[model samples]
Target: MTALSIYQQHDRLLVAVDCIIFGFDGQQLKALLIKRSFEPEINKWSLMGGFVQQDESVDAAAVRVLQQLTGLENIYMEQLGCYGEVDRDPAGRVVSIPYFALIKIDEHEEELLEKFNAKWYALDKVPKLIFDHNRMMNQAIERLQLKASTQPIGFELLPEKFTLTQLQNLYEAIFESSFDKRNFTRKINSLGILQKLDEKEKVSSRKGAFYYLFDRDKYNKLQHEIKKFI
Candidate 1:
């Protein structure tokens, strides 16, 4: 049989990409969710997703879905896993590739979120999601925790300039555990990837905390080295 003839005998399947967009507001880890607009499970909370087009790769489809919902581009993203269970989707036989992205919450477009009726839900308090989305989200969170342990990927969720306290809070929220302030500060300082700025953030207290910026160049140079901070 020819290439086209052999492929024609196989069944056609619908492929899709689902995104678990994570954000850190300096206090809590949040996931962006949307209430389903159309049927099968109408009006239920779901991750942002879309059908993959014939011309686009899976990564491209994920980026497109994220951009459509958040109005942001080139954010940090990674493939979580594939969900191909036979009865995962009620509407049809669909194979979904799940992706997780970390974005600065303050940088996303508020208008797009409002347009899509999407809201940020704290990781610990997210509602029941439709289909296998809950499993996808749980797995995504696990992957994020693992990624953060080895790399400074968590910085993607924070602002360009932030206090060390904000960074510690983000890690605590992600791991859902408390870290001793002194130990956490010392561990972060040992990383040597943060540049202490002369400016101080006076909003929180009379004795303001010094602002620090993540040095991307230094981090890049040390990318091959394994660094762990918990």
Candidate 2:
């Protein structure tokens, strides 16, 4: 192929991933966002991501983008969806493949998350995002709600040792609705994932609620068994 033909086949269509990093800080659901460092909306709040390279897969590119922006190498990430609107990115003709992650936020390099000026915005109250990012955020929130209920995946946002109250709070935040404390505890206890700890957290309640750990190994085993049984 000649230079002109190569140029035509270059496929210059810009490809990028927008990461919606969600975390639980023991109280509510939060999302990781960064200030854009490059134009066309330099310094504006946006999801952390970058262009895909010729040698990498979409998942690989998303991981690289997350690491570059937040310094987090391994975290729970899922391909939310693709936002391919022609005018989604103002900088150029680009198709932004959106991805989302749910982590403990305390699990990764905190210094980098802060050094990059990546701020954690409460899911209940988020800032105005750029371009089609608002739509992405909305979809992510819906996904979280659905995933939290049907699948035993909410543990990703909490510490290994979590309290029943903490579990309830996470559900409340995701659902944006109040739940009966007694019923919530009773229901979660039935799941058989929580491992009771002797320790108690008195930071909030004067009575001090007991701390419990969400055993992932057990949950995963049960999950697999469930599929086989079904």
Name the best candidate (by lDDT). Answer: 1
| TM-score of every prediction relative to native | 0.98, 0.88
Estimate, for each residue in 155-227, the C-alpha lDDT of model 1 and write its tens digit. 9998999998999999999899999999999988887789999999999999999999999899888777745
After superposition, which runs of candidate 1 have C-alpha atoms over 4 Å from their true positions?
none
Query: What tens-digit string does per-residue lDDT give for candidate 2 at 55-96?
Result: 999999999878776666667788987888888777789988
Worst 10 residues of 1 by lDDT: 221-230
Clashes of 1: 0
For model 2 the local lDDT of residue 92 reads 84
Question: Every model's Cα RMSD, please?
Answer: 0.9, 3.2
Runs of candidate 2 with Cα error greater than 4 angstroms are 1-11, 224-230
Candidate 2 TM-score, C-alpha based = 0.88
| Distance from true location, Cα of 65 in model 1, Å | 0.3
> For this target, which candidate reaches the highest TM-score against the unseen true structure?
1
Per-residue error for 47 in candidate 1, Å, reads 0.3
Overall local distance difference test of candidate 1: 0.94
